[model samples]
Target: MITKGDGMGGARRHGGRPDLVRARVQQGMSQESAAQALGVTPTTWARWERGEQGVRASYRPRMAALFGVSAVEVERWIEGWSHGETSSWPTTDLGDSSPAATVKSAALLWRLEMDPSRRHLLASLPFVPSALGEWLVSWNYGTPAASAARRGAGRVVGLADVARINEARKAFGQMDQRFGAGLVRPVVVEYLNGTVAPLLRGHYDDRVGSELMTAAAGMTWMAGWTAFDLNRHGQAQQHFGQALRLAKTGDDPLTGVWALAALTRQAIHLEQGTWAVWLARAAADTARRAEAPPRVMSLILVKEAWATALQVKSAEIRDGRRAKQVERLLTEAERAYAKGTTDRDPEWTSRFEAAELNAEVGVCWRLLGEHRRAADCAEAAVTEFSERLPRSVQFNQVHAAEAYLGMGELEQALGTARAAIPVTKALTSARSVDLLQRFSGQLEPYGDTVAVREFRDHLNSELIA
Candidate 1:
């Protein structure tokens, strides 16, 4: 990605946002005149209008005054340039083709997410049912419409091909858990584009095609999950949306549940608690409507409870009923778990077992101020969760730290937080980094203490450096 002012010599006007250039033109101010008014060089002003230079924060008011607009409007212009909307900043040039072009789109979304100025654009997108409904409309009653076939007209595909796609998804999931999404996401995207896209284009019977679409949906959801873990939230959101379409095409309600649950998880991470709760509820409803297994229902309910817990503070203060509702959902999740038989669980759902439930429960308790219970559950999850799920273990450890901090056990809080540092330092998960940051925030009140200062320094060097 091209930083501001880097491509002044070769910068073109095609790719970036047009507001600045348009403003300059509409104001009828020659580049040199604008520079004179702004107390800058003609070249600098030219670069600014060309979207190749950042207008400093100090200059926003001046620039906005000159443009007869508010400083916030000027800031929006800068945000446009920063976000790659109008800039000719080169992104991953994956060539102009179906999967490759889509891959390039993914790269752009990832870049937009990484840019702090542009991230709000991703996080602020409303999680609306209309978007999901639009994707689902193409499903065509559980049949891959001929037009939906990749490669235009295609050859006979079989069950083996579908099985291979799912197996690859499983492999990617395992790699993601053991390492981090950064290690697995590119590979998954590449595989989806290079291998899976071609297979979807191939001809197959209705049964084979439906199975293939189901597998494709699962793979797409895995891609979205990895992207989410890597903090490319915009890309993840798009992938989840597409996965929903694929699931609908295959009549794969279970996979659709996965997509909605993943979306809910993303919403929660973004602190859009309302969307999270609604999406999770939608997932549970979809699961029931589709007659998904007991295990799937339990997973959805737990996810719903997690979302509800995030909303608990305000909801409890407002109506005083949300807390009880959340508790009821948690109990329902546990009852569903009791009814679930692991024998028929899919590879994806298998990870949503007792340890995960305990971790989610701990999270709910922590958020609700039940620190003692939260600490117990978190400690248990940290101890019992498999090493294969290193990222989750780090999260649980941090939750335990939060619980300790809430209970005023600073020493134990610091120790538990420090213990998770190695795990966090090794993983590329943004969520783990965010958890560590939250833990640091909990220590901010004790800034005068030696332990707090030392922990802060250690955190900066070990996790951030």
Candidate 2:
């Protein structure tokens, strides 16, 4: 019998029998089948049925389809209320970036990331910080700083071991560049937990320990970055935080600053413009404190400019003052780039060359409402993004498309979007997928047109297939 109740009150409205369970039973499907259909774990499905978790409203349509029920029926079944009884479930999204929550979430991520099998369990974990914070304390909050005086008493480790680890780290970085983070995160995480963790605990002298810790910290940063690329923001936050702690422990200020810069990128993509600015400034300040080489400093400055551009584009008051500040930051970035040579910077900064810089400047201008310049810079950057950086090319293509859309060049936007589709399709970066999704949303107004519809269809086929 279908039980109905007034669209008020809690799960008690249906005597604590969640409609999710009822719907599934009615459809004659087991939890495993439902989970398989939804592409989630059976455990996750159980939680939903038991009311231990709430389903994202965006997922409702698919859930409804899977359960062989109308979307309205699923909604009524889950909430024990009819339409208009409450706000949509999306309003209840638990993801937020308060400082305390961020730290707690990062710590949890550090644990979860070490166990690949348990990583799936993270989907059930409550909201973690969606991005990293700027403060030095943020990184060191949950973890202890490594001390130089502490020496491992196991088998003695030497500079050769540390060098090998760095080499492995570099190799993983190259893989990520060519194939995207989704393809490389597992390998990186395995290396960290399997190989690097052992070396960290092995016997080493003071100097070797410092180098080893710093190397480990660098790998951690890479892990965090890969997580971010894969759209695992909380995991990314935790990894970066871990890396920062390791950097401090090893007394490697440069790595710590770079970790902060990575966090800034997270904030920017997560649309926390204010947080992005804060993190970027912290990175620059940290660099200055360490007297970082001009090349590294220049990279940090550009990151700040990028963050500032995000702020200006997203702010209610997009006036000349904000625009000028963005320009000033960009000018400083250019000067730094001019003054510093790549040879003086770390291997990591090698990828942030002229092409990358141009792409950033283009994106900055686009966000600030300078569509013409943004398009030009973006187009040029696209040409400069060689095969070495597959994901970057895909990312810049989306930027180019956005510029065209802003300038009302619908055909150009559609064309550019289509070209970027295949590039993003093969890559596992969640940010890359998000960019395409956002681009699709941007085309919704013009979706009635043949070109726009064709592009949308192409996108849907690629993503869904």
Candidate 3:
């Protein structure tokens, strides 16, 4: 009564599912009957067995029950069927403080990035806001011990290799700033998988190994940043997490601070204000432990201010106390930024100069409903940003436009936003496009005026074309 050839053909065609097929046979259940028990269609069951689709987490328990196997065993069978695809990878375990484990985890992530078939699945992974808290806890309490040189049969890496990675990181970062992530992320991933990954697995002394890990952390952070620019949230989060672990393993708390701050920004973007605030605070604490430069502290404070401003915005009735807190944080950030750069400042901190600070502060002001101050700060940021960062210029231009819109200056807003169109069209940043889209939504109150109509036409043409 097992029903001849039911689901077995699909399983055989897909291959590597002999165990799954045997489980069904032992239970004396046809594919149709199993599907009925699981409350899924027969075709869905067939696809699952064929490795064409994944088993949902909710269905795994029932599946384990039906097969008389543990849930973990069910997962292992699915993973085997998929040939251990990135889809089966767990999002938890940000990697321990061991250099070997860090390298292994980072290599896995780079491979995930490079695999075309599984890249979409990785991007589709949900952003876990709760992970921010776990990461913070680990970062605060985790003390990594020095790892011994590996005796693996891989090439011996050196400081020269570490130098090359840092140089490549700088180049990729510069390109990403100018052109956006769409053009730079692929090349960065290629370098990480093809070049950096092998070096990480290779042999090296503690000194060289630590530097190598730190260098790799920088490149990985760049990879995450570009993914974020392209609005690939889940992929960005994973890269950031891996980067944090790599930094910890490398004994480079400064780089770890950067990763934490990046997570804070991502949390803010996702509107998880509480997580953002905590992550930013954690970044500040880590930076202090590293004795980071003033500019670094300024950057962390700005992130904290941004998160606090959001909290104020989300209040049912504008929270005055939090509003004052935002202002105080911004003031402290400005004071710290004024101390300027030093020899100790990391290369990555260069991007958070005056223009970036003004841009972020303007955002805080706009959220607090101070339209005039927001417009002035935004315009200042626009003027300060150079052509070397076309994407930044475009982003600030849109922010200026939004601030103008906030003040009911339709013509000025439209004109400022129009100025960004050319640059926006040239760049590949999803965030820039998203900002423009939101600005378009804000123009609805203008009721199809000639200026508004013309602007909309231009935007539609540029975006669609």
Candidate 4:
């Protein structure tokens, strides 16, 4: 029964005849009982027996343990090579900024509103926030423009939505503390889609052009993110492109760099590694051309490093050189961002630091299948986000779990993933669903087991709903 000719020229190496079914029948165990033992659904297990779907590799060990057989035996059956079948699973991964980042960012707004020190500072300064905001931005950016902005803090020119804008900005900060800063993508995108987008689409006077452009740039970036979540890849690309264009209209280099980074994320997701590197590099280049603060520029460089790592192998000559330079530049940026000895910092650059960079690099390593490096970088990222622990924390947790999965530690991976699931449920980020799907896929190896079945049912119910 081992070798059998099928449609293909190659002979199929078949395992036992529906091992789980045969074993259960031999032991006089009912289907439900067997299913429960293996953490699987009766229907799911039934499907496996009926040759509807093959089992995943992760379940092999669990099934082997339950059925008193070796994992190898379970693995053989899991492949289902009865008629010369081949498995096409992707082991290596590429990290794309998920929509969940926006949900997390929106949540931070709630937290920032509560910070008394920030409020008191605004009230006491008697200076327009734009002046202080610009000054702080300068310190982070290392630009003469920031110095000009600091000196220009002459009077209180409270713009029309100053109070509301301040409140919203504070809330954005709080989200970083609650969800983790990296998860701001969806939160920001949602705000724009629900609130900002509609406003932009409505009639507007030329007088509001600057404000409108700023808002549009932000929303366009979000659209790119939402398109990514919906898996409308081409749409996502267009959104990113629009964001960059809008940023230019506003002459907002910081926002422009931010938009380019989003483009890099899309490239990474689409498996266009070279394109990703090119995009990241261009973003950094754009930032350099701008009169942006050093902190902002650092973020762009860090992104460049991320893109390079994704597209280039460390062993390759040109790629290795570029990636190494990116890594060094990223480190430099991290050092500059965290050197917050200044009196104040712009709210925009407040989230920049070694933690975010470490998290990103960790993702880069995780995607490359460097388990040790991935886990280390992930740990560093988690540690970095420990104080904020918002949606960014959840993203990092998933990153850690992914690294654990790469290390062949399913238990840790599942446990880490579980911590982020409900804790971040209030956020409507597609990455959450993607993470759940990933976990389910990892568990599929034990198709007929109780845990796998329970999880499958749980996942199916939610996905269907």
- The runs of at least 3 residues in candidate 2 whose Cα sits more than 4 Å from the true structure, single-residue gaps closed, are 1-111, 114-117, 123-135, 138-149, 342-344
TM-score of 1: 0.75
lDDT of every predicted structure (CA atoms) = 0.72, 0.72, 0.83, 0.54
Task: For candidate 1, write residues 154-253 as lDDT tens digits.
Answer: 4667788888898898888888887888888778877776677767767665677667777877877887788788676666776787676666555567
lDDT of 3: 0.83
RMSD of 4: 19.7
Which regions in candidate 4 have their CA more than 4 angstroms from the true location? Answer: 1-158, 161-212, 219-239, 313-326, 341-346, 383-390, 424-426, 439-465
Once superposed on the true structure, which residue ranges of model 1 sit more than 4 Å away at CA? 1-20, 23-151, 315-319, 342-344
On TM-score, the leading prediction is 3
Stretches > 4 Å off in candidate 3: 1-87, 90-92
TM-score of each: 0.75, 0.75, 0.84, 0.52
Q: What is the lDDT of candidate 1?
A: 0.72
RMSD of each: 7.5, 9.6, 7.0, 19.7
Candidate order by lDDT, highest to lowest? 3, 1, 2, 4
What is candidate 3's lDDT per residue for 1-465, written digit by digit as tens?
011123222112345455666678789988899999999999988777665555565676688788887554665565553423433463535437787777778888898777653465566555778777777777788877467355556898889999999999999988998898999999999999999999988989989888888899899999899989888887899889888888888788899899999999998988999999999999998888788999999999999999999999998999999999999999999999999889999888988878899999999999999988988888888788767789888988888898898989999999999999999889988988988988998899995799999999989998998
lDDT of 1 at 267: 82
Query: Residue 465's C-alpha lDDT in candidate 1?
Result: 68
- Cα miss at 428, model 4 (Å)? 1.7
Question: Candidate 4 at residue 190, lDDT?
Answer: 55
